[model samples]
Target: MRIAVTRPEEDAGPLKARLEALDHEVVMAPLMTITPRASVHIPDLPWQVIAVTSANGIRALPPGHGLTSIRTLTVGPQSLKAATAAGFRAEAQGGDVNGLSAFIRAELTPAAGPILYLSGAETSGDLEGQLGAAGFACHRAVLYDAVPAAGLGPVDALLRRGEIDAVLLYSPRSARIWRQLTEAAGLSAQAGKLRNFCLSTNVASVLPEHWTRLVAESPDEQAMLALLAQKGRSL
Candidate 1:
């Protein structure tokens, strides 16, 4: 199967490798571009933990911020991997913002210190609000921004040629971008023909209603990959 991966370029390599390992031809069609915010600073405070909702947050950390000793809590496996690679003492939640907030509530307390949240300019949900409502001090720093792509010409061409078998959508924003771009390119009908594998129901919700959408049981890449493998076997 030829799979189109629509995650941002910075995060697409691993997913592409995973798809290739499963013996599928991969098409890199990033729907969003990650831009690091200029002059962003990691708050120099006695933080209880460094919380990240995406790997881009960790990647956006400025060099020599002197915060590596702080324990990092990531929203998922990929963010955890990024935190670990950045030489921080890191742990990961099950996945998603709610789980991460719950994990922090369960494991840590506000009395310890404030949580330093490194995040993108646009977030799907209010992680800070959830923790703040629980009497926790959240110092949020907008480290990056995920900007939608202008077009998806490569993917449009592939869809028109009937060469793509599926599309892997990781976020609702990216899925929305794909839907809008495909419509703009006049490939909406062709795009509907391919299987659409989404990381979560929220991600799938924004896609065209008539499109064949398969959502992962869990909102993670592993689960999304499992859906692909299971569906591939069935096909």
Candidate 2:
């Protein structure tokens, strides 16, 4: 199966390697480029815990500022791995914002001090607002920004030829960008023919209604890859 990956190149490396390992032809067609925000300065506050929604957030942080000592809560396995690799004490909060919020509420109290939420410029959930309303002080620091791709790149040609078998959507923003690019390139019909393996329902919701969409049971990369493998076996 020929799979189209629409995640940023940096984040797509693992997925591409995993797909190839499964004996599938993988196409690198990133719909967004992640750029780290410049002039980032960690506030001199007594932050009790750090919240990371994406791996990019961890990547954007500069090393060696007594950061590794902080307890970190990550959105999923990927972010947990990244935070751990960066020497921070990290724990996975699954892949859902609501689940993370619940975990925070259950594990810590408002008196535990403020949480530093290292996030991208554009986020799916209002983590700060949600945590704040829950009586926890959550300070969000925009560490990176996802810039949309200018064109569809090679995926456009493959999509038009109907050579692609599946499309992997990691985020709702990427799915929305793919929709825009496909419609703009007049390849919506071709795109609709391929199977869409979304990381979550949120990602699936942004894709074309006519497309054969498969949402992962869990909102994580492993689940998405499992969906691909299952689809491959069926094919």
**What are the models' TM-scores?**
0.96, 0.96
Error of 2 at 6 (Å): 1.1
Q: Give the number of the best model, judged by lDDT.
A: 1
Q: What lDDT is reached at residue 5 by model 1?
A: 87
- lDDT (10s digit) by residue, model 2, range 88-126: 999998477777888898889999799999999998878
* lDDT of each residue in 1-235, candidate 1, tens digit only: 9998888889989888888888999989988889998888666789999889999999997777888899899888899999999898999884998789889989899999999999998886689999999999999999888988899858777788898999988888888888899989899998887899988888889998899999999988888888898998876
> Under the 3 Å rule for N, CA and C atoms, how many clashes does model 1 have?
0
lDDT for model 2: 0.87
TM-score attained by model 2: 0.96
Residue pairs in candidate 2 whose N, alpha carbon or C atoms collide under 3 angstroms: none
